[model samples]
Target: MLSTIATTIPRRALCVRTLPISQTRYASHGTPHYNEPSGYLFGEKPLPQGQKRKREDWELLWYYGMFGSMALAAVGLYYKPDTRYAMAFIPQLLTALIIFNPASKLGH
Candidate 1:
């Protein structure tokens, strides 16, 4: 019975083709809006050249991380009498560099 059902089903013909980069609008802007009728078949939307996406859900995290670490470092920098303040300052600065990236932002 299963074999008969399998044999009864028809197969589809799949034809795939590629368009040249110069021929496509995407060549000008790296982002492909899945808002297009057929774009959903592709993957995530890409970042535009020299532009960025945001930290849609991570705004609170970033604020807490950035200013909190900065506060620690800033306090160490000004109030502390010793150069050991550099220790806290360094990690916070690096954290800012890593987390506060181009695409990363405050608020959703």
Candidate 2:
């Protein structure tokens, strides 16, 4: 009786294996679907006519100036112990101010 039951289960499992695939159609040559229009099909907005990009010449000058001053201060500190290492901080502080002022304007 156990042998008969095991033989019947395999036949039932084989009968359940067949199924159907759902069908979908595409345009000629089967191009993929996309939500956004392609760049070639769309026109990009031109930048505003009057507003100018700000120049960074002043900022660059400040950076290089402060760097040179700091290097000089470091050499001075090595040669003269009386000249405090703290003096080197002045140019670094000014450089921080110059760099941050323009950046702070962007937040507004």
Candidate 3:
């Protein structure tokens, strides 16, 4: 008994082109895109080309004491009238107006 086999693989070399990457490979890599956000739980600071962002004042009094304790816990969860029609206190009144609107912004 005997056997023989032949193989060929050339349907235009199994086409998958998707081309258009010719900006000199990002001008030889000097900072085409690395907008500073390193590994491990997101951390990026990057701001000293003209220096700005420095919000202090005890961090706006700790975000105005976390918007007055989430506006007294959304007024005790809408002071119970069958949980105020099951409104669920609208995410603590939208997180107490987004932590008191940037701590009542003053400068930055």
Question: What TM-score would every model get versus the actual structure?
Answer: 0.25, 0.24, 0.22
Question: What are the lDDT scores of the predictions, listed in order?
Answer: 0.69, 0.73, 0.65
**TM-score preference between candidates 2 and 3, better one:** 2
lDDT of 2 by residue, 1-108 (tens): 999999999999999977668655557455656646646433544448996756567988998899999999999978875756778877778667775343355566
Q: What is candidate 1's local distance difference test score?
A: 0.69
lDDT of 3 by residue, 9-79 (tens): 34345575756776445356676466565663546456779888778679888988999999999998888
Candidate 2: list runs displaced more than 4 Å.
Answer: 1-55, 81-108
Best model number under TM-score: 1
lDDT ranking, best first: 2, 1, 3
Error of 2 at 51 (Å): 17
How many steric clashes does model 1 contain? 0
Q: Which candidate number maximizes lDDT?
A: 2
Per-structure clash totals for the candidates: 0, 0, 0
Model 1 Cα lDDT, one tens digit per residue, 1-108: 998767655332223454576754545575664455645444457777998756668888899999999999998988867777688677678677786444546665
Evaluate model 3: give its lDDT.
0.65
